[model samples]
Target: MRSKEIVIRDVEKTFQTRGGAVQALSKVNLNIEPLSFVSVVGPSGCGKSTLMNLLAGLDTPTGGVIEIGGERVSGAQEGNAVVFQRDLLLEWRTVIANILLPFELHGVTWLDRKDRTTNRQLAEDLLRMVGLEGFGDKYPFELSGGMRQRVSICRALIQRPTLLMMDEPFGALDALTREQMMYDLLRLYDQYKCTVVFITHSIEEAVFLSDRVLVMSERPGSVVRDIKIQLERPRNLSTRMDARFLDCVKEIRGVFQSQGVLAEV
Candidate 1:
């Protein structure tokens, strides 16, 4: 088997809220293999976002360990990139500039690297890959919600990260746009073969994008089920109509139903 890209062992997190100590995560254990697409789904306030934060090393766990690429993560590493719910693009920078922001912020002088020219080409290529090629000269405000989010995705990939951590990256778009972005993201994943840990609340989105769907429980969130998605690759809108696709959706819905999260609708 391929080596694990990310490993979380018996992890626990607690917060000292105004109400007192609130348990956020308890005994969370997961091993994500290299280049696998994994989606995490759960009810609201289930610490799903917190889990992403932990993996990004933005926050430390109250207990337990997190290892990425065989090294213990103490802080954000270049190997990993995160795209949040919001685009979080700098308004002052142009599209290409925004995409190169990470390298710039890290004081990585592009001129010094042997692959500097190739890296610059890759940045432009990524923007194009997300369908933002011609708009590289435009500002973030000049773009629409979906467009800006696409730029964010390009920025995240410019680093050529080994792992991508996405927390509802497409949550703000319209239904049609969300579906398009899902396929776009899957295309990028296939091309780069990068490990992805996506956090989303949409059951259909989760089933469509993941190699495995991890169903999480409410507060003090814990994994309730880890369902493998055996669907064929290059999945698109048509895949949603497949019987196997519906089965996967129903299985996830059943988990949510058991937790009283899914209502008859």
Candidate 2:
């Protein structure tokens, strides 16, 4: 599962708008080790998601190259899955069916009986992993916001992707639900051990779940700091109150303050 090494070299992106070209990223370089959890944080409109899109193969860099597993990224490839803020579940589909949708989209069907059976079993296991075991027969409308995101996470994991790109996956939930989801996500990360590149605005959230937090500059965003989280793993709600966690939060906040991005926080 830790077979891929993400190498982003001298990446740049310029988007064409009605006014003129808007340079979003410039001379960005990143090297994500295999099986590491990395979070990206910066001000609004600072190309954080733009960088993620490039890594996910949804958009191309105007310059430089991105390589995963030592292969140049030309388009969306297997072993890469994305989860956004929204659940994006099929309302008509049952919970298990929604989780199984990826297999169908990838063209797995009854013809490959063995693979299909194995994947079905894996789906059930993932549902249990995310604490949604008995809800498989339920529909998305029947579940709460947190439960829906849990299904979304299970759907992403069903692909067995080596790299999981998440853009604010829990941004929509309330505070309590969001806190619960964070712990649940850590459990999933411990089990899966895949490389994760997460984008978020919450400094505390980034510090809680990440092995390293990459901070970007303002507009035309570039990596300003890559701070390693010193807190031990198997972290929980109590970990947030630790002295080191508070220190890490303050350190990242200082970077933002220097950039005049403190007004938003």
Which candidate number maximizes TM-score?
2
Which residue pairs of candidate 1 clash? none
1-265: candidate 2 lDDT, tens digit per residue: 5548999999999999999999999999999999999999988889999999999999999999999988999889889999988999999999989999989987887699998888879999999988888898898999999999999999999888899999988889999998888899999999888999999988999999999999999989999999999889899878999999999999999999888888563
In model 2, which regions exceed 4 Å deviation?
A: 112-114, 263-265
Kindly state the number of residue pairs that clash in model 2.
0
lDDT of 1 at 239: 95
TM-scores for all candidates?
A: 0.94, 0.95
The number of the candidate with the highest lDDT is 2
lDDT by residue (1-265, candidate 1, tens digit) is 2234789999999999999999999999999888889999998899999999999999999999999878888888777899999999999999888988888888668677855566667788998888877888899999999999999998898877788999999889999999999999999998887889999999999999999999999998999999999998999879999999999999999998988887787
Among residues 3 or more apart in sequence or in different chains, the pairs in candidate 2 whose N, CA or C atoms overlap within 3 Å are none
